[model samples]
Target: MDEVQVVVAHSERATLRVGDVFLKVDADQARIDIEVEAMALAPVPTPEVLWRKPPVLAIAAVPGTTLGRLGGPSTGSPAAWAAAGAAIRKLHDAPLPRLSGRAGRDVDALAVELDAECEVLVASGLLPAELVTRNRQVAEAALRPWAPAFTHGDLQIAHVFVDGDEVTGVIDWSEAGRGDALYDLATFTLGHEEHLDDVLAGYGSDADVDPEVIHAWWSLRSLLAVRWLTEHGFDPFLPGCEVDVLRSRM
Candidate 1:
């Protein structure tokens, strides 16, 4: 029997890889429902659903490696990054899902949540107060209204798969929902800002994009994710990582 490889193990969910199959064990049924439905509605490439039982979703692994890893540099070529951007553009252009359970983030709630999270970081002494303050101010630009599109709420580079210059698939649809189109673009290039031009070029001339807002989301996401990553036993303080992302805002 092939050994089961733990891809990621967190309290809310876990992913295991055994041979060519990836098993997702999620305690939250609502999130699972959203993932399955979102994958079905998505027009781009995604992992093949093998079967589903309550709390466990099995999918055939897609070929190729992730576009990049968090807390690390990306080896993906400019063309591959652009391919990812094109895929996101296609996803944003697709018709919105009719399902009522589309997940999203509200700016007003985000403000309150950011305040509370910053307090936690400050009180815990996990980060310098000035670092948190500057990022918060930088993040405010993304708090404005945006026309919702079918967005992969957590469109990290690691979620995108690529073979050479072609994007083979995108995984983790749990956070997929109606949200800002630029949020996806911003999320993909969070740690890899140099690739933003290639991505935008691939995304083409359909919609206007705000560079400031993209940068804002970068600061906001890094600030908000630092604590979550640490709690989950992941390091956000690695060199040129989430912490650096916040500091770069200063």
Candidate 2:
């Protein structure tokens, strides 16, 4: 029998891997429902659903290694990164899902939340006030209206898989739905600024690609993530992580 490997575990959810099968255990049934639904609706490759029993959903692992992980060096070549970008473009061009996703939140509401979080970060001394203030200013550029696209709300680098220069699949669709296209682009390239051009090269020219907005998202995501990450026992201050990404903007 294959040993169970803990993929990730936190208060909200846990994922376990046994051989080729992965079991996702989430307390929120709605999130599970969304993950299942989003995977079904997505045009891109996704993990095969093996089974589901209430809080635990099982899936077959996709082929290939992840493109990379945040705070670490990427083993994937530039072509692989571009292929991942092409796959993302395909996903963005797909039809919108029925449900609203995390990335699809109202801009005004998100701005309000961001402002509140910024205030907390400063008052709590979680981040330097100057850093917070500068990032907040940069973040304002992303608060404007945007055309919705089928987005992978949390397109972290680790979620994308590639075999050589071919993108095999994308995973973790719980946050998938209609949202800003650049948001997904920004999320994928976050903390890996060196590959932004390679990704954009394959993302194509027709899509509205704005460097300023992408930079704003880098700062905004880092600022908003600091508190939650710290509380969740994640060290965002590590070299080449969220804090470094924020600092790059200064």
Candidate 3:
């Protein structure tokens, strides 16, 4: 393996190499005969697989730093945000092989889980039926074609690999699917409302994404989710329960 010494120490997950195929971890989903696809990297915290070209692609992980994010979004100028958005535009339209399939997601399992949660909420009268309805509407709108273009299913910032001021590449190809590119773009721009124009300008595509649907899912996650969690007495410190459970489609 070619050693690219870019850090002082390496984490268990960090391995230095140049163009060598990484061996999948034993029992890891990456090990199975499944493909990984490109998706818009969102702001959520999840393990992602980022790629870099040459020169600066090499990395040496600092020991004990693996548990957190690498270099994250810039709090500086909107220009940096603009750069990220532009990079995402390039990534969305790029063509490659389909990397994943929705085999593991169990429809019955999700129904059971959601039903139980809804029941508990109803039992306590903490459930806002309107919020649930809103959430459903949001999900439904985001569930389909926003326009004819490539889409990154799980568009978030964490999947974006930022080097210096530029997003070199994006990681995590798990939820990539063929659908409206706007859905993914909307997800990317939701939290960063201020730079919405920069994001739109970056998305140099003729296709259009449903703004209402984007607004709907945005509402579902930002409003209904908070309301539900507060009513259910769910603590952010608690284990097993993740915000992703509520916004799984994102």
**Index of the highest-lDDT prediction:** 2
TM-score of each predicted structure versus truth: 0.96, 0.97, 0.52
Task: Arrange candidates, best TM-score first.
Answer: 2, 1, 3
Q: lDDT of all predictions, in order shown?
A: 0.89, 0.90, 0.44
Q: What is the model-wide C-alpha lDDT for candidate 1?
A: 0.89
Alpha carbon lDDT of residue 145, candidate 3?
31
Q: Which of candidates 1 and 2 is the stronger one according to TM-score?
A: 2
Clashes of each: 0, 0, 11
Best by TM-score: 2
Ten contiguous residues minimizing lDDT sum, candidate 3:
61-70
Candidate 2 residue lDDT tens string, 102-183: 4467999989999999999999998899989999999999999988998889999999998889988899989887788888
Which of candidates 2 and 3 is the stronger one according to lDDT?
2
Error in Å for residue 236 of model 1 = 0.6
Residues 1-250 of candidate 1: C-alpha lDDT, one tens digit per residue: 9999999999889999999999999999888888888899999999999999989999999899987776676787788888888888999999977545765678899999988999999999999999998998999999998888998888988899989888888899998888999889999998888889999988987678989999999998898899999999888999878998898888
Off by over 4 Å in 2: 100-103
The residue-level lDDT of candidate 1 at 50 comes to 98
